[model samples]
Target: MFAGIEEVDWASMKHAYGPADDVPALLRGLASADPAERERALDGMYGAVHHQGDVYPCTLACIPFLFELVADPWVPDRGDIVELLTSIGGIDLGSDDEDEIDEDEAEGAANYAMAAAAVSAGAGVFFGLLADEDPGVRLSAPLALAALHDDPARVLALLRARLAAERDEEVRLALVEAAGRLALRHRPLAGPVADWFARLVGDPGPPGLRLAALAQLARCAPHALPGDVVPVVTGLLGQLRTSAAGPGSTRARPVEPPGQGAEAAPLTLRGQLRALSAEETAGRAAPWTADLLRTLHAGLDDRVAERVALLADQLRSPDPWQRVDAVRMSDRLIGGRRGSYAELVRLVGEQLAAPEPRLAESAAQLLAGLSGLAAPAADALAERVAADPADWVRTWPDGRTRLGSAATALARLGDPRVLPALTAALGHPLVPSELGPGVARLGEAALPLAGALRQRLSEAVLDERAYDRVGPVLVALAALRAGAAAPEVLRVLRGAPDAGGERLRTAALRALAAFGPAAGCAVPELRALVRRTGTVEAAEAAGALWAV
Candidate 1:
């Protein structure tokens, strides 16, 4: 081996940097007489194999050497080396080290190895360290184990022991973090974790830890936490949940001078919950029901409004258990003096005008529920519905609350004011045609407004910005029974420029499909559109041609 090795060219050794032979050479150089030579050899070889971008060989060769370098006390600033250790296969801290290791090295190695193992679940070799002599290592091990490997039994046993025997504050806290992470993923761990969580519920370690425990309890198994614990978490989360509502999470009502009509008590959880039940049983007819919700609704100041909204959101939740509180809050807001039918319509209007669509949808649902029974309020909502501008709709976008929900809300409201808005929306590029039923549902209320709408569509059809408007317009046209606008539709399909005309052609076909034989001349245009774009527009046009 020495005969050929001494003569080999070192400068041109990049080709020989493959893991198989290079790993041994680099390993032997770890304790070379010249530190520069040792450092250079390891750095060059590690860099080449890792960056070479081949997954298998790089992982196999680098794991042990990286661990050795990480353990080497002589090497300072080991973050980069540790990160390298994690990037390939994770480091194995569980491996029997024949040499005795210091506490700091063990902790550092445990943390670094855990981070690496998180990427590869098969890094079970690190699991045995759950019982490491160092508390930090013990605490950190569970987190690593939870991520890289999954065995609820082992995790449960370690956590149980830590909960029982762990006396150090920091270690106890780490155990809580581990428990939350474990319980959050595997619900079965909730029993033991909840025991630990219950101990710290109000004891107060750190704000972050408490919040984490609360979040874990809320997310994993709310019932596992004690009933007393639930309210504390609810109160804290309620404060956080409602921090945006008004001024402060809790508000003080003025003390009455002996007789202010039973001086209204500040809404408490128990009372609000009771009212929520009454509201559900009584529905719109129950006299006491609406008042229950109103009490909570009245709590909405800038400080408490977020809580109010959160409560309302909960009332509206699809989950029956959550609905009681949400209903109680909503009833109080909508039916009680604080939230009454009159107030609800106004609130809905405010949400409609709000920049956020989610708020607008909430307002819309409130309006929909109140429709007819709250006829005067619905009438008022109608006017605002018409004035609100349109927004783009996408099934999947980067953000959750987009403008489409507001449009849907308006449609769901079915108030007449929506007609002019819908007609005006014809030019909106993002509105989808699927909204026709919603617009049409508004019925003859929309009929009287059709003439004015036709003029807007005609004007919009000619504008350059009207490209995206074309499809939605046609969809709305079908919605409005604006069949007479067929000629205008045909003209746009035939003559509009390519820049905006593509949508026009597509909308033209869709409109013609909606128009049927009444649009006989549109047959040629429909065929043209289908050939130009392979969309439903083409298929609808072909169907329309046959229907004609």
Candidate 2:
């Protein structure tokens, strides 16, 4: 079946690395006995061939081989190969949603469809995998079918049938979602598909499953939904509170098992590929309601304001799980649209001062993500950061994360009054995650704080946390063209973690390079870095020296 692999002019084809000569070896590596080697080969293939999902022409060239690989049960990570084929074949295009929506064509939808044609042309394998003995393979089959530009509806019946036969909860969840996306894109199937989802919502084994169905139902057929939206949401929230609080997995790194949210083992390949982001993946080890919470928020199209209000109420719920879900909803509701919610911002902003440490921290983080849309709550966020307990400096659980969250929110608000607080935060030995980015957002406008930033660079401690403090400040200072920072940055880079770790070294070198010839004083240390290590840091150091 792979005879064609050698027949092609492989040398001439371009992958991410400019030539496809290495493609055949990587493909063979998929079946390697060594898991580590196979993992490396897979990573290499994705990086060089798909290259952050920019499918090259050579990507299409490998389609037939992938189809063959997916059909062979002997191939390890066969589900991953199927998913790879699906991603290569599928385009992220706008739904066939006829509703007046202000949405764009899925980013690179055209390129995606064009790349996916190679796999769709071999649609027979995908359709066959829907009933494969391995549940992992079966899960990916429907997703692959969803990529079908031409016979999308052809897989609808197959998915529904599999959903009934499928005993594994994760596989069933993917099938239902695939069905929803297909129904949305292939408008003709909406009525029947919507009815299927509606049926699942009321008659359910688990509340998460039902909530997932309702979310999809609302999305694919908003007008077809029943009148009692709020009550259904209320029940789902109750179920979530129960789920999240139930004895979560005790493992250091937990992977949720199929059908059960209470505990997790190590994740399967199928588990990692789903829509939820990596950050959301960890919570799964806990009895996670995050997926449903995210889906419900994402699915609400009609009565959106009412749903948002309901979500806000739940954010203030006494149950920790309900509150966690609500906090997540606040971030999701904004969805980058300034016009979407006035009340959401107000409520979440107020939550920034909530007595519960978790709620206040989550609220601050959410506000930072909302940017200028969260401007109205800037005053409250600023006050919270200002009122950070004096004892927080040494014993804070996350060092400066909580304080930084509030300061970051103020920076995003683009309010000038945020400068004093931000400058103080930046000068602290433990800077918060993304606080430097918030500072960078202020750009050259932060030039006024250049003197203090330089002083902080010189005086800051070089503890493990020092990297976070100095790295972002270095980047921000460079962005602000604070050439005066070169000397202090040079000192930190030559020093150890006790002076600031590799993070500061890397950032300082990059900052020096940003200064061009203005960083002349650091030439000796930069040359030594190139000579001693010759790693990525070496390259950065060499570049800095050249610029100097």
What lDDT tens digits, residue by residue, belong to model 2 across residues 113-206?
Answer: 6666666678777777777777678767787788664676668888888878876666677788888889877888999999888898879556
Off by over 4 Å in 1: 1-142, 148-175, 182-191, 202-211, 214-223, 227-230, 238-405, 418-443, 452-469, 496-506, 516-548
Model 2 regions more than 4 Å off: 1-4, 92-115, 243-280, 283-292, 317-325, 335-360, 368-403, 407-548
lDDT per model, in order? 0.49, 0.70
Give the TM-score (vs. native) of candidate 2.
0.62
* Candidate 2 residue 115 C-alpha distance from true site, Å: 4.2
- Sliding window of 10 residues with minimal summed lDDT for model 2: 250-259
Candidate 1 lDDT over residue span 324-358, tens digit each: 34433554445433332444344344444544444
Model 2 residue 479 CA deviation (Å) reads 22
